[model samples]
Target: MDQTQSSSKALTLARHVLRVEADAVAALADRLDGAFDEAVALILARRGRVIVSGIGKSGHIGRKIASTLASTGTPAYFVHPAEAIHGDLGMIQRDDALIALSNSGESAELLTIVPIIKRQGAKLIAMTGNAASSLAREADVHLDAGVTQEACPLNLAPTASTTAALALGDALAVALLDARGFSANDFARSHPGGTLGRRLLTHVRDVMRSGDDVPSVTPEASVAEAILEISRGGIGMTVVVSAERRVVGVFTDGDLRRAFAQDIDLRRARLADVMTPRPRTLAPDRLAVEAVEMMEHFKINQLPVVDDAGTLVGALNMHDLFQAKVI
Candidate 1:
């Protein structure tokens, strides 16, 4: 009856919703049989784009599935079922593939277009709760998205069925992605405006400080010089390079702290004496996320990016990765 009690009840209900939806998704994994394989083959064999259509709540799920397919190299778009009946059916072509969603597999709007779609010679893939329904029998491939029960308290709602359809759609997208050897870079292209795309597609050259901004010292420079470069560059580390400007090693904050712990003399010691030998470096063209992983794996905060011949071209730090959303 109190405010805290009401908040707690809402949280509990939200948790239950998540758990039920997760269970609905897990059930689909177990139900992946020959039908799934046949549907996948149907999509892969099509030389044209996939045209997805559905009505009502199924329409929203269809749109999302279409987006996922597009971003993952499947090339798809959603066509509203009612809209299709009003001349939007021209969006489909003979070489294209059509995926229809109808829980009962007998949506009037969807059924009316099925004959027309077949007459156009486009392959039809049906996802529905009833495998014996008209849409399923007419489809070149039928994927049963049946759920035993609804997660909704009232059985009239489409909760569990929609969750099942969404999960099955994701499975198809990922399977086709793998089959096509879709790379992280490939996914990034479709999502270039987002953080994930920046992380996956951005290269060390894109985020790293280059030319005069890169901090460095020769083998003969004193530890004091290394500290000055580290401070001036504000990256907490400096690359040690040979006379040809090839990166030979690096000195970092951790190295300085540990050296002081060992009673090493910064006032008189050369950078070569305290520098880490062959410190890990990234290529200028390496993905920024790859740099994040390497840094995290080695527990380092900064890296020197080099060219093919090992000459230091740029410098990058955890801050750079954070700014680029690679973290």
Candidate 2:
């Protein structure tokens, strides 16, 4: 074939493959019934972890499904069906539930282990394209992941069927997540190294500047002194506090500019005269992401961390959050 003709055919085939896979996933929503619900309930009621088993392409999809379930509050792990036949079958306990994936629903290795799994009292949930296959018939719950055709041009490869199975796995995980009332905080605990974990698990106290690192001046101090404190703190702002270190106001670079524009003498003006009174403050126990939201909403770059009694305990800025990777 000419280069132009070959390129045109390749593009057409790629589009066709994408359409087939998309259609397969879309069809799953319509096919979902009581079986899907039964699968979710079976997994939820199990006292032990979920064991996902498959071979070949389905094995790869099973690994991903297991990981998703594990990270989303479901205790799950993957076990290769081939390995299970040898010795890994011991991992399945009476309280655990097994999700077996096989597009054909006739995988010899899976069928070999089904009788053993049932004998041990563990429930079996089968995901297969063939509803009438032996594996589905033996399963406690059968989820139909069938597709009309493969994304492969030859109509023999597992393409669209595997996509359907993967989508069904995700649907089950999401349903279980909702049924269990799994919150974002619960998800974060399982993914402490991820961005969502950082945003949800980190608090203002973990990132804010405490003790002497916080810049503060008495309300009686001159505006010039507050400016010096701001410069020393390097956070573009300083808190104005009373005798007991309770936050009374805040003086920022913006306030300095206003003072300059109004021709007010910094050396002569008291902090109370030019500072913004009753400025927005955050509790040290608040989530760092909440601080980010508050700053973005108010268009401010700095905030004083206060205790329940309104005492200045710490301070933080946009730079602080960036350094902590909480921004």
Candidate 3:
């Protein structure tokens, strides 16, 4: 065939594959019945983690399903069915739930361990195409992930079937997440290295500049002195405090530029006279993302971090949050 004809044929085949897979997932939505509910209930009632076992392409899907379940408040882990027969079966507890995936419902590796799990009183949830298959008939709950046709031209590869299985697994995880009232904070705890984790888990005190790093001066200090502090601290702002160390006002680089525009004398002017009084501040326990939001809203860069009594304990700027990778 010519190059143009070959490219055209490839694109047509790709589109057809996508349509078949999409249809397979759509069909699963209708096939979801009371068995899905029973499967979810069984997993929820268990006091132990879920054990997922499968072989081949189903095993790859099983690993992803296990990860989604684990990250979404449902405790689960995947174990190879072949390994389950060779001492890995010890990982399954009597009260734990089992989700086994096999398109044919006849994987010898899966069959060899199902009986052992059943004798231990573990709840079994089967994902298979054939309801009459041995694994489906023996399972406590059966989720049908059958596809009418494979995306492959020969109808042999596990394409549409795997897509349906993955979608079904995601549905289960999301449903359980809603049922358990899992919050973003809870999710962050499970993914501490991710951006979501940094945003949700990192707090103001954790990233704020504390101790002498915070630029501060008494309200009686001159604008030149505050200017020196701002320059030395490199946070673009200096906090003016009362005799008791309570934050009273703030002087910033913007203030200096405005002062220079008005021809004000920095050496003689007191910061208390020119500084912004009662500037917005954040509690040290607040989330770093909250600080970012406040800065964005107020069009400011630095935020004074105070304790419960409004005493300046730390200071943070856009740079600090950015450096902490929390911005």
Best by TM-score, which number? Answer: 2
Stronger candidate by TM-score (1 vs 3): 3
Q: For residues 108-192, could you state the per-residue lDDT of candidate 1 as single tens digits? A: 9999999999998999999999999999999999998988777776767899899999888999999999999999879888899
Q: Count the backbone clashes (under 3 Å) in each candidate.
A: 0, 0, 0
Error of 3 at 2 (Å): 2.7
Tell me how far the alpha carbon of residue 85 in candidate 3 is from the true structure, in angstroms, after superposition.
1.4
TM-score of each model, paired residue for residue: 0.83, 0.98, 0.97
lDDT of 2 by residue, 138-242 (tens): 999999999999999899999999999999999999999999899999999988999899999999999999999999999899877888899999999999999
Backbone clash total for model 1 is 0
Q: TM-score rank, highest first? A: 2, 3, 1
Off by over 4 Å in 3: none
Global CA lDDT computed for model 1: 0.91
Better of 2 and 3 by lDDT: 2
Error of 2 at 138 (Å): 0.9
lDDT of 3 by residue, 1-327 (tens): 899999999999999999999999999998799988898899999999998889999999999999999999999999999998888999999999999999999989999999999999998999998788999999999999999999999999999999999999999999999888999999999999999999999999999999999999998998879989998888999998888889999999888888888888777899987898999999989999999999999999999998888899999999999999997
Select the stronger candidate by lDDT from 1 and 2.
2
